[model samples]
Target: MRRKVYTKDQILKAAYEVVENEGFSGFTARNIAKKMGISTQPIYLEFKNMSDLKNALLDEICNHLYYDIFPEVRTGDTIIDLGLSYVYFAKEQSNLYNALYVQEYGGGKKMHDFSYNYFHQLIVKHPKYSKLSENKINALHVGTWIVVTGIATLMSSGIIEPTQDEIVHLIDRTINTVLQEDDTSVLDSL
Candidate 1:
């Protein structure tokens, strides 16, 4: 049968949509091609293998999450709102969230490391944290992983029955206690 040709962008987009709607386990060249109304050959021509396709998808998800959501999270902003937004994001984009945030689709240890580095850099950039030594920055990396991951995990798992406001407060109090700082909008000044 003759097949339609899809661009690299189209295939990657279809792959992401498939993962979001069908979950990571549902991801495959066949399904993606079906969604794109094209053939697997196009994907093969664009990518070395499925891992390459997934890695591309992961990179795209990382870019979207970091630029659209993570940067918008102001430390000086309402902790409740931040927590609410996080939960909302998870629920709203469950499939992407599960794939990028939860699912072990393609060995996401590097993704985790990237997240850890991101927060650590943010902390280092903050005037409050700038005074801290290298050890302090390292400590913040560990601290952020423990706290933020815990919050994200809780919301993503849907096991904790907490309201947005309550979750915000919980997250705020936890971060505040650890940082020993009252300000929430740490990103604005920088």
Candidate 2:
């Protein structure tokens, strides 16, 4: 009898399929083996442990997001288009989205940190936002992120199915409300 052989790339690809289809809950040695149509021994041979495999999977997901997904999501409006694209990605890739966003998979770096950094860059690139103070931009980013993430969660979970127009409206309202910031209740009390 000959032993079956599998490459590291093959193993990682299978692991990605498992995570994409079954979410993080399905990210196990057994699932990867089943996806690859092989035994678990090959997985152990290719990687040190599940953590190693998971890190590899996270890298793949990030690559897909940056190179494959985000590129297709672009529209004229950098901010609204990004939000819409995020929502679309969640709907299209629910299981993958859950693994990346819902599950704690980044090891040391968290999903929120990644989002904040991305938003920071987006803010800096915007003509209107370019002159704003860093603190104001950060506040606006938090506000917009909250709304966008909430929408993505709802769409991913099938709790609500909003139209593209609705998503745009929501993002607009959120950004406007946060950026306006006229009322100062804290100072009123003081």
Candidate 3:
């Protein structure tokens, strides 16, 4: 009998599918092998261990978010567009969202940091935020992050099913409230 051979990319693709369909809990070498219709030996041969495979998977997820998910949303407002993209991701890719945010999988920190920094830069460069000081912008970004993440979490968890208008309205209201707050002291504290 001939031994079946799988490349590293092939194994990672199988792992990605497993994670996408089954979330992180179903992310195992055995599952990947099963998905690929091969023995675990091919997976082991392609990677050092599960941890290495996980890191690679994380990179794939991040790339998918950056290239595939985030770029698809364009609302003419960078911050709102970002929020919408995140919400779309949560709604469309519930399993991946839960694995990254809800379950706090191995890639959670990397994803969080990437999202935070990306949104922060958008806020800083936005003309609507130009009148705001650095501290104020930072505060606004934090507030936006909380609101967006909260909405995404709720939707992903099946706690609420808000329409696109409702989601946009909620995000707009939160941003407006942050921008309109008269208490500069609170903004400066951050």
Candidate 4:
């Protein structure tokens, strides 16, 4: 019998699907083999180790988050839209969210740092935040992300069922409080 062959893309795609359905713990060579109907030897041949495969899967997940998920969250406001999108992402993809943020399965940048970096980049891109200093922007991101993550966790855990409007109001209040002084001193206390 001829040995089965699997492309790198096929293996990575299978791995992503396994993780998407089974969370971070589900991403294993055996699972990918089962998903793709191939032997684990093909997976091993395609990837040096599980870590390598995980990095590839992380890239795929980031792409999904940035391209597929982020675009759908819009409210004519960058900050609000991103916040809503984050919460919605948690609700919709709780397993992936927990794996990326809570479990740190990607093993590279933590979601907290990623969120901070994302918020900074987002702030820089918008004219409204052009005048703000880096520290102030960092403060604002931390403050607002706290609220966003809290709402996401609650919703994802099924502990609470807040509507989108209520979430928007909470985010607005958090942003206002963080930016009210328009100074970096608030960041010191945080």
> Evaluated with lDDT, which candidate comes out highest?
3
User: In candidate 4, which residue ranges exceed 4 Å CA deviation?
Assistant: 104-110, 182-190
Clashes of 1: 5
Task: List, in order, the clash count of every candidate structure.
Answer: 5, 0, 0, 0
lDDT of 2 at 10: 95
For model 4, residues 30-53, the per-residue Cα lDDT tens digits are: 888999887799888988999888
lDDT of 1 by residue, 1-190 (tens): 9756667898888998898888878889999989987778889999999988888887887777667866665446433333455556776666666676677664267567766666666665676666755554555445444555566666667766665566666666655654663333342122
Best by TM-score: 4
Question: Which stretches in model 3 have alpha-carbon errors above 4 Å?
Answer: 1-3, 130-134, 181-190
Question: Model 3: what TM-score?
Answer: 0.83
lDDT tens digits, residues 86-134, model 3? 9879887888788877775646777777787777767677788766776
RMSD of 1: 6.1
Ranked by lDDT, the better of candidates 1 and 4 is 4
Candidate that beats the other on TM-score, 2 or 3, i.e. the better one: 3
Better of 3 and 4 by lDDT: 3
Reference-based TM-score of each model: 0.76, 0.82, 0.83, 0.88
Candidates' C-alpha lDDT: 0.66, 0.77, 0.80, 0.79
